[model samples]
Target chain A: MAEISFPLPDLGEGLIEATVLEWLVTEGEMVERNHPLVEVETTKSAVELPSPQAGKVVRTYGEPGETIKVGDPLIVFEVPDDTAGIVGTVPKEEAPKRRVRLSANLDED
Target chain B: MSEHTTLSDLEAAQDNTTAADVQQESVQNFPEPADAGATETMSMQQALNRALAEVMTENPRALILGEDVGQLGGVFRITDGLQKKFGEARVFDTPLAESGILGMSVGLAMAGYHPIPEVQFDGFAYPAVNQIICQVGRMNYRSRGTLPMPITLRVPSFGGIRAPEHHGESLEAMFAHVPGLKVVSPSGPNEAYHLLKYAAARQDPVIFMEPKSRYWQKGPVNAGADAAGYSPNGSRVVREGKHLTLVAWGAMVARCLQVAELAAEDGIEIEVLDLRWLKPIDAEGLAASVAKTRRAVVVHEAPRTSGLGAEVASTITERCFGTLKAPVERVTGFDVPYPSGDLEDEYIPNIDRILYGIQRVLEYRRG
Candidate 1:
């Protein structure tokens, strides 16, 4: 599995760094691309940086209240098949169950 | 050590010694970048980019926010490759509104982060004048020193390459007039690199004006200066002389050097002082030089009447009145709106006009 390390981006122009407000998911959690991974505060606005890839969270850098510069590695994601372009996440399957149909209700009455 | 090529051809136009001036020895000692290690012969645009990148690399609190600073890498490409290197969260773009860019910067500074917002162009900065002139300049005072706003406003200014109406201008005097703001305009790539780093790491708001004319001018700069070499508060003497003092900022500084080459042929040693820091100008340095020369000439791309040149001339007059030989002169743009590209060369102070101003000052006699 390839570990994709995503760096913090310039949330806005002239902004070089941001303070980590919170991490949305714990390490080892499965995440999809565009998922809100972390909330960072730069200037007066607080924004969540979306995950750039769908993968199992390998590790996260910095803690709450910690400041991180743009380009500093923030989160690492482990992917089974490391795709070059953006890869979407598919959630795990739920338990299988039977369904009942009510299409003949009027004829039976 | 001077690599600058003076306009020797200009001497042919007027019967002055422009050729001899350009041939003078030891004009200046532009520091070698390798003295510190890992230097690049980058242009002003690239130098500024490296400074922004280095500052961002060192300080987690420094962030860049502006229009097209991200993805597009800024209009001048100064901020190009920064967004990708820093991340969109830290090097992101903003709306086209000028006020919005600066307004957010003020808020960001108050939130305990240092912000460097790019105003894009000289003309585009007008919309953000309110935030820059009123709030950004007075925030520390308004909060009674409780709030410290360390915002560096990056504005590309000056004329010569025939840019559109608003893009070509030198509004340093307007911003320098605002109290609590440090106005700085770098003449070349080195100052652009060092000054931007100094401005970004300071505790006050700085109007960091980049000379558009010299954006492509290449020079060697200590790629990384441990943020220790220069402070964004003083001037630099680009060339040393004794006959008279030539005070200029931004693009005009380089032009003054060319003007000096012409004046040298006439046996007039012109001292070229680059007011890198416009506001809180190096009055002491300027006074000392003007005192020795007993003559002065101020140059800028702004309209005359009440531009930066006037301010410099007045200050020198006030400080060096006892050692005065003649009235301080000013060579500047006409007191009207800038004309189109075809007429810009004439409207802005070229080397010819500057040479004329220097000659006029040299002829000054206390009658």
Candidate 2:
């Protein structure tokens, strides 16, 4: 089985800690990339954290009302056994670099 | 040897004649105006208009683009009659799309024109956020110096006037967070006019925010040398005091002025600082003010969390730690979406809240 770890995404302004307001998905439930997993309240406003990878939720590190920093793992997930080899593999750095370039082109003249 | 010397002497004589002729033509032009005294008292809108008019007249390449700027002269009439005075080519209106307006301005700037585009309202500027952050903000760095986009975005923002949702927003932090952009907001008419003129001359992209609520407010404009002190990247001490430095920008500057007046009544002396420029902030001036006052309170109309005030407070604390007598406090908008315009007074920090903040800081200093 493959493991999926969800890191905090940028909620704007390089904000680090956010209070966990609620968990939409529970352990043992399946989730898809970009699916809302937890609701977090920042000093500015409440935001929903999306799953970065598709997998079955195996565990949660923190409960509601706890504040977590950036890069803190919120949920762990188990992927299909067949896809286990690719599950935890980190994408090449070139991928993000290329994507940023492409997005920049779309907006830049 | 004699033939070569003769040819060289002839070339030198021709160069001297050409240089003399060029100097004569330059001297024949009209003389510039003499530095004169300052003119006091102009509305914020008038200040902006004067800045635009001055810049456009001084620089032929400078132009303005915004909705209703051409015929209707903008909602607040800041651009009133500019189109007629400057001709449509220099000052004109755009389609109702903020993204289109900003994106087109990027293209215009790339073509070597200085385009100062206006977002009609604070809330309406959201559509262009993508263009602003992803494109306009990073274009210079992304291009690796091959392109320099010197566009100024003029957005009239903030609340207090009972307008609909999206009318009042202090989005400076959003722009400030971007790496390659500059952000500025003026507290009064003089600053608005002077800052706009500075923005027109700048070579980098600038987000110039105007306080919508204070559009009609009037103040000493200082038409001469005092105007020179207003720059797009500097802060000014609007009032003199010793106990604490109260920092604010845009419409809040006026509010801070009112607070200072009321505080004076209570026998508390407070210095008011107008942080005209948001990005590339005047750190030196701010540090100096905080050093003298020993206490600081940053105020803004934006929400308290992750707002521009947070950055100012942290910076002051980091640089002026030993000099500070109390923890830097912030009088800002409640950590909530801007409330209805009617309840804005409650949500937005006012004279009373600022007074309370001053009292708290003073009390902390006592202990």
Clash count in backbone of candidate 2: 5
TM-scores, chain A, per candidate: 0.73, 0.70
lDDT of 2 by residue, B324-356 (tens): 878999999988888774688688886678877
Local accuracy of candidate 1 as per-residue lDDT tens digits, B1-367? 1231112322222232122222111112232223445456777877888889988877666788998787656766677677667676677889999999999999877766678999878889999999998889998878766666789999878776666678677788899889878788888887899888877877778899988767766676665544354444567777889888899988788777876766666566789988887887777878878887787988888998778887788889899998877798988899888876668878987777777777676655556
**Model 1, docking class:** incorrect
Q: Model 2: share of native contacts present?
A: 0.00
User: What lDDT would each prediction earn against the true structure?
Assistant: 0.75, 0.74
Off by over 4 Å in 1: A1-109, B1-39, B225-232
TM-score of each: 0.69, 0.68
Model 1 over residues A1-109: C-alpha lDDT tens digits?
A: 4345678888898799999999998998999979889999998699988887688998999999999999888988776421321211111222322121111111211
Model 2 chain A: ten consecutive residues of lowest lDDT: A96-105
Clashing residue pairs, backbone N/CA/C < 3 A, model 2? B39-B222, B39-B223, B41-B219, B41-B220, B41-B221
